[model samples]
Target: MGRLFMLDVPENTSIVDVARHLDDVTVGRIGPYMVIESGDSVSIDRRSTDVRHAVWYSCVAGIEGWRIAQWDKDALRTEPR
Candidate 1:
Protein backbone atom coordinates (compact mmCIF):
# COMPACT_ATOMS: atom_id res chain seq x y z
CA MET A 1 0.00 0.00 0.00
CA GLY A 2 0.98 3.64 -0.47
CA ARG A 3 0.72 6.59 1.85
CA LEU A 4 -0.45 10.14 1.18
CA PHE A 5 -0.10 13.09 3.53
CA MET A 6 -2.15 16.25 3.78
CA LEU A 7 -2.06 19.26 6.07
CA ASP A 8 -4.77 19.76 8.65
CA VAL A 9 -6.31 22.98 7.41
CA PRO A 10 -9.92 24.03 6.97
CA GLU A 11 -9.71 23.58 3.22
CA ASN A 12 -8.22 20.10 3.60
CA THR A 13 -11.04 18.66 5.70
CA SER A 14 -12.81 17.61 2.55
CA ILE A 15 -9.72 15.73 1.49
CA VAL A 16 -9.97 13.56 4.58
CA ASP A 17 -13.67 13.09 3.96
CA VAL A 18 -13.11 12.06 0.36
CA ALA A 19 -10.36 9.66 1.31
CA ARG A 20 -12.68 7.90 3.72
CA HIS A 21 -15.14 7.13 0.94
CA LEU A 22 -12.65 5.06 -0.97
CA ASP A 23 -12.35 1.32 -0.34
CA ASP A 24 -9.12 0.08 1.24
CA VAL A 25 -8.20 3.66 2.10
CA THR A 26 -7.74 4.60 5.73
CA VAL A 27 -7.56 8.16 7.03
CA GLY A 28 -5.74 9.23 10.15
CA ARG A 29 -3.82 12.09 11.66
CA ILE A 30 -0.14 12.62 12.37
CA GLY A 31 0.72 15.85 14.18
CA PRO A 32 -0.85 18.54 11.97
CA TYR A 33 -1.21 16.32 8.93
CA MET A 34 -3.81 13.88 7.71
CA VAL A 35 -2.41 10.54 6.61
CA ILE A 36 -4.05 8.37 3.96
CA GLU A 37 -3.19 4.76 3.28
CA SER A 38 -4.31 2.69 0.33
CA GLY A 39 -3.56 -0.70 -1.16
CA ASP A 40 -3.91 0.58 -4.71
CA SER A 41 -4.22 4.01 -6.25
CA VAL A 42 -5.54 6.85 -4.10
CA SER A 43 -7.61 9.49 -5.81
CA ILE A 44 -9.75 12.40 -4.68
CA ASP A 45 -11.95 14.57 -6.85
CA ARG A 46 -11.17 18.28 -6.63
CA ARG A 47 -14.66 19.50 -7.51
CA SER A 48 -16.35 17.30 -4.91
CA THR A 49 -14.23 18.82 -2.15
CA ASP A 50 -14.86 22.40 -3.24
CA VAL A 51 -11.51 23.59 -1.94
CA ARG A 52 -10.16 26.93 -3.09
CA HIS A 53 -7.32 27.08 -5.57
CA ALA A 54 -4.69 28.13 -3.06
CA VAL A 55 -5.63 25.47 -0.54
CA TRP A 56 -5.97 22.73 -3.12
CA TYR A 57 -2.60 23.60 -4.53
CA SER A 58 -0.88 23.58 -1.13
CA CYS A 59 -2.91 20.97 0.66
CA VAL A 60 -0.26 18.33 0.42
CA ALA A 61 2.36 19.02 3.04
CA GLY A 62 4.51 15.91 2.82
CA ILE A 63 4.82 12.89 0.55
CA GLU A 64 6.27 10.35 2.97
CA GLY A 65 7.31 7.67 0.42
CA TRP A 66 4.74 8.63 -2.19
CA ARG A 67 4.87 11.01 -5.14
CA ILE A 68 2.16 13.08 -6.76
CA ALA A 69 1.19 11.33 -9.95
CA GLN A 70 -1.69 13.68 -10.77
CA TRP A 71 -2.54 16.92 -9.05
CA ASP A 72 -4.53 19.63 -10.73
CA LYS A 73 -7.98 21.21 -11.00
CA ASP A 74 -9.49 17.80 -11.67
CA ALA A 75 -8.05 15.46 -9.02
CA LEU A 76 -5.19 14.36 -6.77
CA ARG A 77 -3.41 11.06 -7.31
CA THR A 78 -0.53 9.71 -5.23
CA GLU A 79 1.59 6.71 -6.02
CA PRO A 80 4.43 4.91 -4.33
CA ARG A 81 7.91 6.20 -5.05
Candidate 2:
Protein backbone atom coordinates (compact mmCIF):
# COMPACT_ATOMS: atom_id res chain seq x y z
CA MET A 1 0.00 0.00 0.00
CA GLY A 2 0.99 3.61 -0.50
CA ARG A 3 -0.07 6.70 1.34
CA LEU A 4 0.09 10.36 0.34
CA PHE A 5 -0.43 13.23 2.74
CA MET A 6 -1.38 16.68 1.51
CA LEU A 7 -2.41 19.87 3.19
CA ASP A 8 -6.11 20.68 3.03
CA VAL A 9 -5.64 23.98 1.31
CA PRO A 10 -7.36 25.44 -1.71
CA GLU A 11 -4.42 24.46 -3.87
CA ASN A 12 -4.60 20.84 -2.84
CA THR A 13 -8.34 20.33 -2.82
CA SER A 14 -8.28 19.71 -6.54
CA ILE A 15 -5.51 17.21 -6.06
CA VAL A 16 -7.80 15.31 -3.74
CA ASP A 17 -10.48 15.32 -6.38
CA VAL A 18 -8.16 13.78 -8.90
CA ALA A 19 -7.03 11.16 -6.43
CA ARG A 20 -10.59 10.21 -5.52
CA HIS A 21 -11.43 9.73 -9.15
CA LEU A 22 -9.05 6.78 -9.20
CA ASP A 23 -10.29 3.32 -8.25
CA ASP A 24 -9.50 2.03 -4.75
CA VAL A 25 -8.07 5.34 -3.58
CA THR A 26 -9.09 6.47 -0.10
CA VAL A 27 -9.28 10.01 1.18
CA GLY A 28 -9.10 10.84 4.85
CA ARG A 29 -8.27 13.76 7.08
CA ILE A 30 -6.26 14.51 10.17
CA GLY A 31 -6.59 18.09 11.31
CA PRO A 32 -5.64 20.27 8.37
CA TYR A 33 -4.19 17.39 6.44
CA MET A 34 -5.84 15.52 3.60
CA VAL A 35 -4.68 11.96 3.41
CA ILE A 36 -4.84 9.95 0.20
CA GLU A 37 -3.98 6.29 -0.06
CA SER A 38 -4.10 3.41 -2.48
CA GLY A 39 -3.28 -0.26 -2.56
CA ASP A 40 -0.96 0.06 -5.54
CA SER A 41 -0.16 3.66 -6.45
CA VAL A 42 -1.43 7.19 -5.98
CA SER A 43 -1.32 9.68 -8.82
CA ILE A 44 -3.12 12.80 -9.99
CA ASP A 45 -3.49 14.41 -13.39
CA ARG A 46 -2.27 17.98 -13.20
CA ARG A 47 -4.17 19.29 -16.20
CA SER A 48 -7.46 18.03 -14.80
CA THR A 49 -6.95 19.83 -11.51
CA ASP A 50 -6.83 23.23 -13.25
CA VAL A 51 -4.56 24.65 -10.61
CA ARG A 52 -2.24 27.42 -11.69
CA HIS A 53 1.49 26.90 -11.89
CA ALA A 54 2.22 28.43 -8.51
CA VAL A 55 -0.32 26.29 -6.67
CA TRP A 56 0.56 23.14 -8.57
CA TYR A 57 4.24 23.62 -7.93
CA SER A 58 3.78 23.69 -4.18
CA CYS A 59 0.74 21.63 -3.36
CA VAL A 60 2.02 18.60 -1.53
CA ALA A 61 2.57 19.05 2.19
CA GLY A 62 3.75 15.62 3.22
CA ILE A 63 4.08 11.98 2.19
CA GLU A 64 3.89 8.79 4.20
CA GLY A 65 4.43 5.19 3.18
CA TRP A 66 4.90 6.28 -0.40
CA ARG A 67 7.55 7.77 -2.63
CA ILE A 68 7.23 10.48 -5.24
CA ALA A 69 7.97 8.91 -8.59
CA GLN A 70 7.18 11.90 -10.72
CA TRP A 71 6.30 15.52 -10.08
CA ASP A 72 6.28 17.90 -12.97
CA LYS A 73 3.80 19.91 -15.02
CA ASP A 74 2.05 16.73 -16.03
CA ALA A 75 1.27 14.73 -12.88
CA LEU A 76 2.19 13.61 -9.41
CA ARG A 77 2.90 9.90 -9.20
CA THR A 78 3.58 7.96 -6.02
CA GLU A 79 5.11 4.54 -5.79
CA PRO A 80 4.36 1.77 -3.32
CA ARG A 81 6.17 1.81 -0.03
Candidate 3:
Protein backbone atom coordinates (compact mmCIF):
# COMPACT_ATOMS: atom_id res chain seq x y z
CA MET A 1 0.00 0.00 0.00
CA GLY A 2 0.96 3.58 -0.52
CA ARG A 3 -0.06 6.48 1.68
CA LEU A 4 0.34 10.19 1.15
CA PHE A 5 -0.42 12.64 3.90
CA MET A 6 -1.09 16.05 2.45
CA LEU A 7 -1.41 19.07 4.63
CA ASP A 8 -4.96 20.29 5.05
CA VAL A 9 -4.48 23.72 3.57
CA PRO A 10 -6.17 25.89 0.98
CA GLU A 11 -3.36 25.49 -1.52
CA ASN A 12 -3.56 21.72 -1.19
CA THR A 13 -7.31 21.39 -1.55
CA SER A 14 -7.23 20.77 -5.28
CA ILE A 15 -4.61 18.08 -4.95
CA VAL A 16 -6.66 16.31 -2.32
CA ASP A 17 -9.73 16.49 -4.49
CA VAL A 18 -7.89 14.96 -7.43
CA ALA A 19 -6.52 12.20 -5.24
CA ARG A 20 -9.96 11.37 -3.97
CA HIS A 21 -11.14 10.75 -7.51
CA LEU A 22 -8.40 8.32 -8.44
CA ASP A 23 -9.21 4.62 -8.94
CA ASP A 24 -8.82 2.35 -5.93
CA VAL A 25 -7.83 5.29 -3.79
CA THR A 26 -9.26 6.45 -0.49
CA VAL A 27 -9.18 9.84 1.15
CA GLY A 28 -9.51 10.39 4.87
CA ARG A 29 -8.48 12.87 7.55
CA ILE A 30 -6.12 12.81 10.47
CA GLY A 31 -5.98 16.08 12.33
CA PRO A 32 -4.54 18.62 9.88
CA TYR A 33 -3.63 16.04 7.26
CA MET A 34 -5.55 14.60 4.35
CA VAL A 35 -4.60 10.97 4.14
CA ILE A 36 -4.65 9.41 0.67
CA GLU A 37 -4.18 5.67 0.42
CA SER A 38 -4.14 2.99 -2.24
CA GLY A 39 -3.32 -0.67 -2.52
CA ASP A 40 -1.03 -0.09 -5.47
CA SER A 41 0.81 3.04 -6.51
CA VAL A 42 -0.68 6.45 -5.84
CA SER A 43 -0.24 8.78 -8.75
CA ILE A 44 -1.70 12.25 -9.21
CA ASP A 45 -1.36 14.26 -12.37
CA ARG A 46 -0.22 17.79 -11.61
CA ARG A 47 -2.23 19.45 -14.34
CA SER A 48 -5.40 17.75 -13.17
CA THR A 49 -5.07 19.47 -9.83
CA ASP A 50 -4.55 22.88 -11.51
CA VAL A 51 -1.97 23.85 -8.93
CA ARG A 52 0.97 26.10 -9.60
CA HIS A 53 4.56 25.00 -9.15
CA ALA A 54 5.07 26.38 -5.66
CA VAL A 55 1.89 24.92 -4.20
CA TRP A 56 2.38 21.59 -5.94
CA TYR A 57 5.92 21.16 -4.66
CA SER A 58 4.98 22.04 -1.10
CA CYS A 59 1.78 20.06 -0.88
CA VAL A 60 3.10 16.77 0.42
CA ALA A 61 3.04 16.93 4.22
CA GLY A 62 4.32 13.37 4.73
CA ILE A 63 4.26 9.79 3.38
CA GLU A 64 4.25 6.21 4.60
CA GLY A 65 4.71 2.71 3.13
CA TRP A 66 5.89 4.37 -0.02
CA ARG A 67 8.52 6.50 -1.66
CA ILE A 68 8.27 9.25 -4.24
CA ALA A 69 9.16 7.49 -7.46
CA GLN A 70 8.34 10.46 -9.60
CA TRP A 71 7.86 14.17 -8.89
CA ASP A 72 8.11 16.63 -11.71
CA LYS A 73 5.97 19.09 -13.64
CA ASP A 74 3.86 16.24 -14.94
CA ALA A 75 2.90 14.16 -11.93
CA LEU A 76 3.60 12.80 -8.47
CA ARG A 77 3.96 9.01 -8.21
CA THR A 78 4.47 7.05 -5.06
CA GLU A 79 5.31 3.35 -4.90
CA PRO A 80 5.59 0.86 -2.10
CA ARG A 81 8.67 1.28 0.01
TM-score of each: 0.88, 0.91, 0.96
Clash number by candidate, in order: 0, 0, 0
lDDT of 3 by residue, 1-81 (tens): 778998888999999899899999999999989999999998899999999999999998899999999999999999988
Residue pairs in clash, model 2? none
Please identify which of the two predictions, 1 or 2, would achieve the higher TM-score against the true structure.
Answer: 2
Lowest lDDT sum, 10 consecutive residues, model 2, at 2-11
Ranking by lDDT: 3, 2, 1
Which predicted model would earn the best TM-score? 3
- Give Cα distance to truth, residue 30, candidate 2, Å: 1.0
Ten consecutive residues with minimal summed lDDT in candidate 3? 1-10
Look at candidate 1 and tell me the lDDT of residue 32: 83
Cα lDDT tens digits, model 1, 17-50, are 9889998998988898888888788888988888
Pairwise TM-score winner, candidates 1 and 3: 3
Q: How far does residue 55 in candidate 2 sit from its true spot (Å)?
A: 0.9
